[model samples]
Structure formats: C-alpha cells, structure tokens
Target chain A: MAKIRGSIVVDVERCKGCEVCMVTCPTGTIAMAKEVNHKGYFYAFPANPDLCIGCANCAMVCPDGVITVYKTKI
Target chain B: MTEATGIKEIIKPENLVYKRTKIMTDNVLSYCPGCGHGTAHRILAEIIEEEGIQSQTIGISPVGCSVLLYNFLDIDWQEAAHGRAPALATAIKRLLPDKFVFTYQGDGDLAAIGTAETIHACNRGENILIIFINNGIYGMTGGQMAPTTLVGMKSSTSPYGRDVKLMGNPLKMTEIVATLPGTYYVTRQSVHTAANVKKTKKAMRKAIQYQKLNKGTCFIEIVSNCPSNWKMTPVESNKWMEANMFPFYPLGDLKVPAEETTK
Candidate 1:
C-alpha cells in the first residue's frame, strides 16, 4: 500500500490560476477551492486523497513551482 | 602485454555519447530511432544554450512525440493538453511578460487538433515563439492522418493511400499562418538533410531571437520527415519530403519586419 504525505497545496500568492495542473492530473484529485486566500486568489486544493494516482502532473504544470505532493510507501 | 598507446589508441575517457546536462531529465527518450524530432530537439537546445536563454525561457511541450519534451529540453517546461501548446504559450507569455516563451508542436498536434489554438495564438498578436514541426503524418500515434500528410501518402488511418476526395488536400500551415497580421516572422524549413538541418537551426534561432525582442508572434514551421511512419528509411524519407512536401510548403522566411528586412 502507498501512503501520500504532505498534501499538494497551491500557494495562492504564487499560483497564476492557469488551471493547467487541474487538467493534467490523471486522478482528478485536485479542485479549485471555493474559498479564496487573503489575496483573493483562488488556489487549487486537493479534494480527494484516495483518488490521487500520484502522477506529479500538478508539480509539473505549476509554472510558479508552488504545488508539492509528498508520498510515503509503507 | 600493453603496447604504448598512441593518440589514436587512447580510449579518451569513453567520450560521452550523450551529454547529461543537455537532456531535460535522465529518463530515456521515448521517440523511435532516427526520428527527426531528435534533430529539432537538439537545435532548440543549442539555440537556448547559444543565446543563454535557458534560464529565462519557458517551453510549452505539445501532445505528440515531443509531448515528453520535459524529458529532454533541460529547462522549465509545461506539458500542454493535446493541441493546446499554443494556448499555453499565450497564457504563459501574457502572465510572465519577461520570460522567453515558446511552444514545440508536431504536425498533427499543431495543424490538426490544435489548429484553432495555433491560428488564434498567432492572430491575437501574442509575443511568443512557435516551433511547428510538419512531418506530414502523426508520428506518435501510429501514423494516423495528419493535416499535412501528403496527398498520396498512406498511414494507419488512411491505409488505402490518401485520397483527395476523402481526406482533403494537405494543409499549407506556414503559408496560412503567415497571413495572420500578428505573425511578424514565419518561415517553413526542414531537417531532412545536413544542409536543410543547418538552415532550420538558423530559422529556429531567428524565431527565438524575435521573441526576445518582444516581437509579435514568430512562427518557424519545420517541414520535417518521419522515416519510421513514412515506411521509408531515413534516406528515403528525406527524398520523399524533398520531392513532395517541399514544392507544397517551400523553404523560406515569409515575413520579416520592415527594418529587419534586407533591401
């Protein structure tokens, strides 16, 4: 079994909201959170952890290099 | 007994066949052997290296064989959805403003599925560089019908030979896209032969340089060849492109700014 750690979080300050990472994730785990950050920038949030196939697409498409998904194989 | 090694006999530290820093990632390229994409990739890298733009450059990887460009481009790259490289380029260039943004796209990826994105990107006057590889067939997807596939060429999707009545004529994208008011520089080049490859590298460098100047959309369309999919050896594919696609697409710069234009 594989365990995912350090959830994929989008830094609102850095994210341009291109939505490219959302489209590339194969697992459909990430979503644009309804709540906006203090800067009013809508950040992409990981909605479902179990669905994440850990493709690293979010990391790849984040132009600002803001998203990071930490995983652990137990 | 070891004889005195001459300069010719010296092993010379097993001269690296491939440079580690040149590759985008250590992951082996998934392209077929003798693929022209390799040539295009090398030339782009050389330009980035020569101009010292690797740090300031942002590349949009397309959805064809070059889709995995992040594996070899050795710079910041974004993998765009199928046919969306141009759109991604537009967005990145608009947002970053300072970075050198370019999109690498194949024939089917650019001329077919992404035609709208490609055309609109140029029409909108986006200050971005577009490297369009028109190999006349979809090399990555098992040689399917591509927008630029020669009239008589046969592919997996058109195994009966491309019939004009059914498949439509091959698209002259460079000529079509050159007409866009936003496109400041448009050239159709090739990498079929050494001479052609050199010319292509020059055109590619020019396009990238145009982007650095904040020039409007500059498009360099390489009328490349897919030997593996064309069912011909590398030599034969070169001959075929020269014979068939060259007259159709032609090789030359279509538009240059008036000041930069030679009198």
Candidate 2:
C-alpha cells in the first residue's frame, strides 16, 4: 500500500480541550497535549501522525472548528 | 519532481480535506467548552454556504443561550423575543416568499414559552425550517429545569430530581409537531458523534431543500448536550445524553411527506 501521510493544524487558542476530536479520530492519532494553551485548556494534537488516514472525522465532530486536516499519498 | 515544503504542499487546494466554513463569522463562539450549540451552528452555516443560499437565507433566533447564534453565523439574522422565533420566521417567509427562512431555538424558548407559536406555525403549514435544540435544561438561566427536562433528571430547580406528578413529564415537542398537517417533514437528531453530526447535517440540508420547494414547515429537533449545565465533562455529557436523552427522544424521522414515505 502506498504510504498515506496525514497532517492536521490545530488552532490552539481556539481549542477548548473538549477532546471530542480525540475520541473521533479513527486511527487513534489524536491526543491531548500536556501543556495548556493560552485559554488554559490542553489542546488536541496528532500524537501518532504515522497512523492517520486523514478521514477528517475529528474535524466533522469538532464544535470549535479548531482542527484542519490535510492528506497526501507519498 | 522537486520536493515541496510541508507548508507549501499542505496549502494546495486539493490537499485540504477540511477547513472552517466561511459562512461562520470570525467572532469566537460564546458557548461553553463543550456546548453542542457551536457544532449545530457550524452545520447550519456549512449547509447554507454549500447550497449557495447565503445571499437569500434569513435566520431567526429566540432568547436563550443560542441567542448569540447570529454573532457566529455570518448571514442575515433577526433576533426574536423569547419563544417567538417561529412567529418571526413565519412573517419573514410570508413577506419574502422567495427567501429561505429558518428559526434556531432552544427547549426553553421552544417547548416551554413558545409552544403556541411553534404549534401554530406548523399547524398553519408555513414554509419555513425550524431547528430545535433540546438539551433538557435551561442552560442560559443557570441550568434551571426546562419544559423538556427528563423525569427524575436533576436541575437547579429540580436538584432532588424531577417529580413527574408534580412537574409533569418531559414534553415531546417534536412528536407533537410532527402530527400537524402543516409539517412536511420532522426528525430528531444529535451531534455527539461524527456519524450523528453527519446525519444531523443531512437532515438540516433536507429541511432547507424542502423550504425551497415551498413545502410546509420542516422541523428538525437536535438532542444536544450542555456539559457546563449538566455538570459533566464534555465526554461524560455525551455519554449521559446517549443513555438518557436518546431513550426519551429517539432519533430518526418522526414524520415525512406521503410521497417520500415509502423509501
């Protein structure tokens, strides 16, 4: 299978650390960052980027619209 | 082939899988950390933008936590009095029959105070869409008991748990409106999970499309969560909603036009 690379951009300040994305990511790629953002909430980040298929499930369920996803086949 | 920087490659139009819809304004949402209102707002905005109805769509919202929806959704909006969104929507749809009109309202504003307007609008068969958010409690009023508060559910006013005999049962407003002859379509949905959000968005899109068809009232009730008001974390609130709200307000279409009922 061709390697599928996925990346996401998190608007940290806009994230409320609700973790809805963490649960929605099908590949289990998302995790809460240890450090809090300016809003004092631990934001979501791609903890296992290699496993991501960029299905955009997290972005679909995100209430804050803080995460943007991109994907490419390498 | 030349190697492309990560930023350069990701910025390409085809590589972008998801981005915030432009229908939403730059203003940050005022909803609490895990409030479902923000998700609902985004779905509506996205649908409007996708359908190319931004120029001709008008939204009306009643007084409640979602009253600030106009601030988040970048479109023409009218603020209606508490529980009067349906009334406002009816007038707007009537005066400007060509425009798409919809009302976004909460349980407190819809089932409780605006019950008359809601029923009358549907009963009259007004060509409009009504987006009802049922979170069980009056989230904006410090989590007071709402008309849709489930039996035995605890709220500020019902801290000891709701008493069915004393306070009455949770009103199934969606089902009630579904029976009206004027309603062309009626369904209940949620946004807790990705699948559910997609389903809700489809429902909203259908409602808007029906509005353009000059069909009667299309009512979509979203069983949402209020993490702050529910005194639960965002995740826990979703779990609680699934366990409680879903049972009382089961999802799926409650009513559909006769012609489309078979499929």
Candidate 3:
C-alpha cells in the first residue's frame, strides 16, 4: 500500500529542549537526543522518521521555531 | 542524496509542509524555555505572513518580558513606555489608518500601570488590536504579584500566597474591556495546546480583520505560562497553568460585534 512519508529537521542549537514537540507529535516520531547540543541542553530529533505524518503539530506548538517538517507521497 | 542535490530537492515548495514564517527575525527568542510568549509570537507572525500583510503592519511593544517583540517580529515597531503601548498604538493607527496596528503587552503592563490607557483606548473605540499576555505575575520583575495573580498564588511579592483581603483580587481585565462600547470583539485564549493555539490564531485574525473594517477596538487576552518565575519545569508549568490559571481566567469570547454574532 502507498503511504505518506514525512521528515522533520530540528535546529539542534535553537531548540531549548522543552519537549513540547515530543508531546505534540501524533505518531511518537520525536524523541530527546541522548547527547546535548552546544548549549548543553538535550534537543529533540526524529527518532521514528518513518512514522512521521508531517502534521506539523510539533512546529505549531513549538515556542521557538526549531522544527521544520516536510512531506512526500510514497 | 548529495548535500547540494538534497538541498535543491528540498527547496521545491511541494515537499514543504511547514517552515518558519519569514515575518520572524533570525534572532533567537530570549524567552525562557516553555514560556508561551514565543508560541504566541510565532502564531501572530504566521498569520501576518499568511495574510501577506507584513508590509502593512505596525506593532507597538510594551515594557515587559515581551518588550523584545520588536526584535523578534521583522515589522515596523514602536517601543512604548511601560503600559503606554495603547497610547502609542492609538496615535499610530490614527495617522496610518491604512496600516494594521496592534500592541503586544504583558499582564503587568496592560492590567496594572497601563490600565487607564487600556480602558480609555477601548472606550474611545480605537480601531486597533491589543494582544494581552496574562501570566498572572510580573515575569520580567522576578515574578511579583500582578493584578491578574490568582488568589493563593504565591509570588515574590505574595510570598505567603495571595491574600484576597490584603492584596485585592485578580482582575478580569478582559471582562472589563468587553463592557466598553468601543470594543468590537473581546476573547480570552491560550497557546497551551494545539486546539487552543488554533483558537488563539483565529481570534488574532478576526481582530485584525475587524481592524481593517474600521471596527472598534479588539482585545485578545492570552493566558500564558511563566515557567522560570513559576519555579517549574516547562512541562510542569503547562500542567500547573491548566490546573490553576484556567479556573480563575476561563477561556472563550466574552463579546462580539453584532455583525459577527450568529442568531
């Protein structure tokens, strides 16, 4: 079956790592990176990229403009 | 894909589901982690950019935690004295009636020092929009008790928790503004959740649309969170706000012009 593929790019340094994105993502595609960024805060990254639906819910809820989402049909 | 090739493919607009609005500057937000002000600012910028009104908007910045709004939004902005954003916005809107004029203010700035200015501007029916960020305490001044601070809410000034008899009660400024004849639309909203964000954005757009129609004043109060001052983690602060603030402030439109009101 054809599916919708989505990807998200996180600006590691720009993220304050508040985890709003992790909570807002519908598909549980985001997770906090184990390693810290230059600012010494754990940043969010797409952990299960294949599950992303590109709803942009994380970007909408993000206090800082850290997450950008892209979508394509597969 | 190679870096350059991938960049070229990504640049194709069709794949873009979401991108940061250009209305916001590249300057990193100075707000504390989990503060709702940044989310509010992004929503405002997104609406302005989507409406293509970037060139026709003028924002008035107040003296508070949101004072740096001018630095974040890449629009012509005027920094007003503490609580004087409405006065400045009034003048700007009068002179440039064609432009979309609005003020971004904090609870301390709008409901306290600028109370009179806020009341009179709405009373006089100024054709402008007012975005009020009510976090219940003075976030910029180390979380002092604000006019909107909930009863029993502890702050720097009310260390023992707000005593209603001693400190008075939290002001419902949005309700007060709705009573004025000059206000065309008045609503209380928040950015705590995706559904709430959508509502807040809709309120913002409606306020701006009414301003274009030369309708009377539009007031939108956003019940936000101040995690740093609240002494809670970002997640905990949101939870605290939902549990505490919403009961005292509540959400939804208090008033709307007859034209917008449905039978």
Best by TM-score: 2
Clashing residue pairs, candidate 1?
B24-B72, B24-B74
Question: Residue B5 of model 1: what lDDT?
Answer: 30
**Reference contacts recovered by each candidate, as fractions?**
0.00, 0.69, 0.62
| Chain A TM-score of each candidate structure, as shown | 0.75, 0.92, 0.95
For each of the candidates, give the backbone clash count: 2, 0, 0
Query: For residues B171-254, what per-residue lDDT tens digits would candidate 1 score against the true structure?
Result: 888888889999999887776454566787788787777777887999988877777788885556667888987888888889
Model 1 residue runs over 4 Å out of place are: A1-74, B1-26
Instruction: Write the residue-wise lDDT of candidate 2 on B1-263 in tens digits.
Output: 33246445654678888899999898888888878898999999899999999999999978999888889988999999999999999899999999999999999999999999999999999999999999999998899999999999999999988999889899999999998999999999998888999999999889888888898999999999999989999989999999999998999999988888776
RMSD of 3: 2.4
Ranked candidates (TM-score, high to low): 2, 3, 1
lDDT of 1 by residue, A13-68 (tens): 55444454566577788877787766565667777755654455565434334554
Q: Give the TM-score of candidate 2.
A: 0.96
Candidate 1 lDDT score at position B206: 78
Model 1 TM-score, 2 decimals: 0.71
- DockQ scores of all models, one per candidate: 0.01, 0.64, 0.59
TM-score for chain B in model 2:
0.96
Whole-model Cα lDDT of every candidate shown, in order = 0.73, 0.90, 0.91
- Model 3 CA lDDT for position B240: 93
Model 3: CA > 4 A from native? B1-12
Could you list the CA RMSD of all candidates, in the order they appear? 17.6, 2.0, 2.4
Docking class of 2: medium
